[model samples]
Target: NDFPLVLQVGEEVVSLGRIACPIILTTLLIHSRSIVSTLFLSHLGDVELAGGSLALGFYNITGVSVMKGLSAGMDPICGQAFGAKRWAVLSQTYQKMLCLLLLASTLLICLLWLNLEPIFLRHALGAGQPTRAQWTSVIGISLAFGYAILACVFTNFLGEAWGKLYTQDPDVVKLISIGLPIVGLCELGNAPQTAACGVLSGTARPKEGARINLFAFYLVGFPVAILLTFQLKMGYRGLWLGLFSAQVACVSMMLYTLLKTDWKHQAKRAEELTAAVGERDDLEDGLINDSNDER
Candidate 1:
């Protein structure tokens, strides 16, 4: 009874768990920088907060979207090579994708870093605080989003009860202080959750991602947010708390999945897949060369 016994688990269970864990960790590492920046800006006062929010929004739309989109095409290639055990191709693909992202980030910095003032002004002009009545109606609509950006915007609105867009009210600042940190926590969690999904896709396990998303966000997160925000009268903090809980849950679940993965098998499969892809490319190149020689 005192002896430690090792029980052999099924391969599928192991594979799913191990694959899922790194994805969650990788995602969190990648996304935490932005959320941390937002958290810092939230402490700086209303103008800085709003300007920072606008900058983040612009970065997501222009820079982040482009980078994710371009890099996404490589997922299947990596996944297939991984699954096929093509090690060399997998390594090359991984390196090439990294290079591509670096290039993209450089280009984006050149474009966005130089034009931030204009972007902030454009967003600031459209920014306004709604009354409590308006907010009640707005929250209903905003609850659908994973990150309720409007909640951040309206944290300042708590001070603008008279319907003014800008305010120097201490009450609003007090409310903002309470809500913004929660926003930071929620956003920080989003990184790992999104990275887990990306990893799942790269492993050709999108259904696992779908399942995790449904259970984590809908079953656990959504109810908690509803309960905290509406039932507890916790307001924006409650909603963000719910989001933080969801991210934690998602990370936990994904971690469990990744811990179970058969990495040796995955490596073998990657090597096989990479070799097949390389041969196909060689054949295509040869055919093109032959036609050019004939011409």
Candidate 2:
């Protein structure tokens, strides 16, 4: 196929002889991952297809796209490192990034498992269909984790007295008293970092979020945690300290990225994408006025 592939090289134009094959191949690979499942559902029935498609769309919008965007941040760093012949650093960066992505994927998968009922209810699955086992597991997991987080918040705000609600054992209560405040401090930093990452992903600048994570978690946070945990003998508190520091770093970096982003440019690009899709939809109702006026 004679697909026009133009490139500007030193004020001169050039064309790739056959670019369509590569472009088509790339498009197929990227889309087929999601589309294949929808195709499988299509064979089941119209309802199944519709529901599957809707759930897939929701996930693509809320999760996978954001993950991909954050991963893109590695592109620049990897490319520059390769070009500069810093092979060791490039390898290290790639390893760290892979580990981070795997960790995030694991955590998200666990969360998905724990929230199956709510997910089903929100999607095509009818309400009240969730089994007793599903409800039991969901409630159990939620309570187990929820109480800890809730206690952390209460303890942070109310101080040592809040620990008394959980246990009468002096030793356990003392541990809780120490852990709650640390967890709360970590959470305070974590909230903004998480929000900033979501915002960055939504704006199509995932690479910035990736850089923030790399520097915050691997570079600064890990070292501090090790130092405090081993050298200072701070134990679990040191781990929480590391988390707080990393979150603060991430928040600061994301805040700067937010301030520097060119909103006008992003808006223009979004409009262009909307127009492209609009042009492709022949049944678009809003375009009726234009057609009528023309007739």
Maximum-lDDT candidate = 1
Best candidate (score: TM-score): 1
All candidates: TM-score: 0.45, 0.42
Taking the tens digit of each residue's C-alpha lDDT, what string does model 2 give over 129-202?
22321222233323334444665567587655654543345765577677778877666556556545644433
Query: How far out, in Å, is residue 142 in model 1?
Result: 34
The reply for model 1, stretches above 4 Å from the true place, is: 1-52, 75-169, 180-207, 277-295
What TM-score, to 2 decimals, does candidate 1 have? Answer: 0.45
State the number of backbone clashes in model 1: 28
Q: Give the C-alpha miss distance for residue 49 in model 1, angstroms.
A: 5.8
Alpha-carbon deviation at 110 in model 2, angstroms: 8.7
lDDT of each: 0.52, 0.51
